[model samples]
Target: MTKTRIMIALVVLLAGLKSNGQEALFGGQEIVSPEINKDKSVTFRLLAPAADSVFITGDFLPTTKMKTPMGEMDAPGKKLLSKNGEGLWTYTTEPLASELYNYSFIVDGMTVRDPNNPFVIRDVSSLTNIFIIGGGKADNYKVNDVPHGTVAKRWYDSPGLGMDRRITIYTPPGYEDSKEEYPVLYLLHGAGGDEEAWMDLGRTSQIIDNLIAEGKAQPMIIAMPNGNVTQDAAPGMGSDGFYKPVFMAPKTMDGTYEANFMDIIKFVENNYRVKANKENRAIAGLSMGGFHSFHISRYYPNTFDYVGLFSAAIMPREDATGEVYNNINETLEQQYKNGLELYYIAIGKTDFLYKANQDLKKQLDEIGMPYEYVETDGGHIWRNWRIYLTDFAPKLFK
Candidate 1:
């Protein structure tokens, strides 16, 4: 190419890089959205000169009634934002308790995330910005200076489901350096959640790392498998192309998942350096995953020495069928006969599955099945689940 032509092309490229449209899109000065004050109060801001109205919705806010497909129910509350002279909308809240919270902005009636905050999480299909208030229970949810563990996304063959699926595994610190074999904790997620649920939303790695460092919990390996039988992995992560996630998927609560549960256990035991014995193994889940924990623990009697159900769904599905679902009482009897080191059940008083868990306790009482029951405040929510894990993990593999 001629020198003149090359010089002209360079000039044109430089001009395009500094174009007005490009500047408007990426050249603006950055502003902080969520600013945590010394007193723990948070101030949220947004610059929208043309926006007619703005509001902030968050789980930490007060509860309000919202309509859903099922009916009008209590949902997270939103607060209006006031605009300053520079057209910057802002809102400040009273001191918040130490915990992780998710929030979204409603600008001109459209819900959006805080562009300034890079921290976010995806629950099902919805994504929201997240921040942590340190110095209490939330301290465990944050990444501190303690030794961190390794988290890997691995694919394992599931012959029962006729496909290769993904699983999230968390190996404790020093796992790779030491010659020790760790105990395994099979953590399951609820419906609509895939292998990534516990790792992302539950803060499993951070909590466990903090717990182990504090000497509150034993060092162990956590294996999270997708509970949805029809899915190979999280949305857009498997053979099925990119797709939106839903609250519930086909064959979630069915017996098929339980029937093929051994595949995950086998994969973990075969691949990882774990103690492959009942006394060294633990199983726990939340919501529908809790339901699976209940059935799987009983069906595979003498498998797990420690079992936990957090706000578990305990009702028997009449339509579901398989060897796992059959002879529930007989399986429970066998499980009790085999012996359990610790059977833990925790639930919030207002959880939808409270009555079912209570009934389960009653049946266990009839048979004199020993279990540790913890009843806390609130309903079926992540706050309770995180608390449950914090309380439950310290008691395992002891």
Candidate 2:
């Protein structure tokens, strides 16, 4: 063909491809799924013309009671989305409070994530779309125009577990540039979570960054270690490759993880520029991780001057047997004797472990052990956990 003919053909082909790409992406007109309004009421839109019905369910909605094997509990309520003439389904929530919320779409009985919303978080086995309502407590969770910290996933040798493990570390702003040695906080995750949990689900980095910038908290290093003893890291992130995650895993609450806790501290102290003493060391966790913190701090009596437990699972398994699990009272007695700056415990009012935490408080009272207790409204949820962290961090290393 001639040169002009070839140029004309190329132009035609490129134009066709561009048209098809736009059609595939937006289906003719652009669709913005989540549009945060000025009134704080969120409008969710989905382009599902062929679907018979559509509904939206999320943590922002009011909860209802649902029966499960454990017992009757509260679950996020579902709201029906009205279909538009163009097949665009939409629903607008009432003015929501400032907090982070996750939701999913139920289209024709199949549950799926919001295709237009790229922000999502994974909790164990499930993934859902997430959004933050600014102007309140959730503002701390959002990434703002502040001096940010560095988040890194580093691997370290764990001889006790007989495998290399991965941990997420957050070094505050100016850490690399400064020669200062900072205090260390060993943060842990619950069952079915890995090093990625606190960073993603709990918004640890963002919260800490905001708190530091606002002068509410001090600059420090946060080391988030995987609590699961059998796995080296999160699924698809470990040496075992990808696998399905479950709510419960073997050796989760066993004494093995607590006994080997020093390995993590050793790795952090050796690798990072941190203050290597009990007074500069702190530990905290949520759910299963809280249980681990409760046991590990006591096991290592004089290691940590600050400890926090949020919605902790207080009791171990019936068959759990080990020296770490045994002599809990004696260990706690020693921990108190060593002198702690802060022994903080926070939980939801309706949490499943409420009674257990009460029992623990009673035991501490009988021993005349001092601790700061906080009770908020909710169950075993991330909302309460984030609040607890926000409250507890301000009181650290002071």
Best by lDDT: 2
Model 1 agreement with the true structure over 1-398: per-residue lDDT tens digits: 99999999988876776553223444323566699999999999887788999999998898776664323434678999999887789999999999999999999999998877878999888899999999899999999999999999999999999999999999999999998999999999986788998989999999999999999999999999999988898999988889999888887887888888999999999999999999999999998899899999998998999999998888877657767788888889899999999999999886767888999999999888999999997777788899999999999999
| Top TM-score hit | 2
lDDT by residue (tens digit), candidate 2, 1-398: 99999999999877776665325634433567788999999999988889999999999888887774334556888999999897889999999999999999999999999888888999988999999999999999999999999999999999999999999999999999999999999998987788999999999999999999999999999999988889898899988888898777788777899999999999999999999999999999998899999999999999999999998888757746877888888989999999999999998987878888999999899878999999999887899999999999888998
Per-residue lDDT value at 252 in model 1: 84
Clashes of 1: 0
**Which stretches of candidate 2 lie above 4 Å from their native place?**
1-23, 26-29, 66-73
* CA lDDT, candidate 2, residue 125: 85
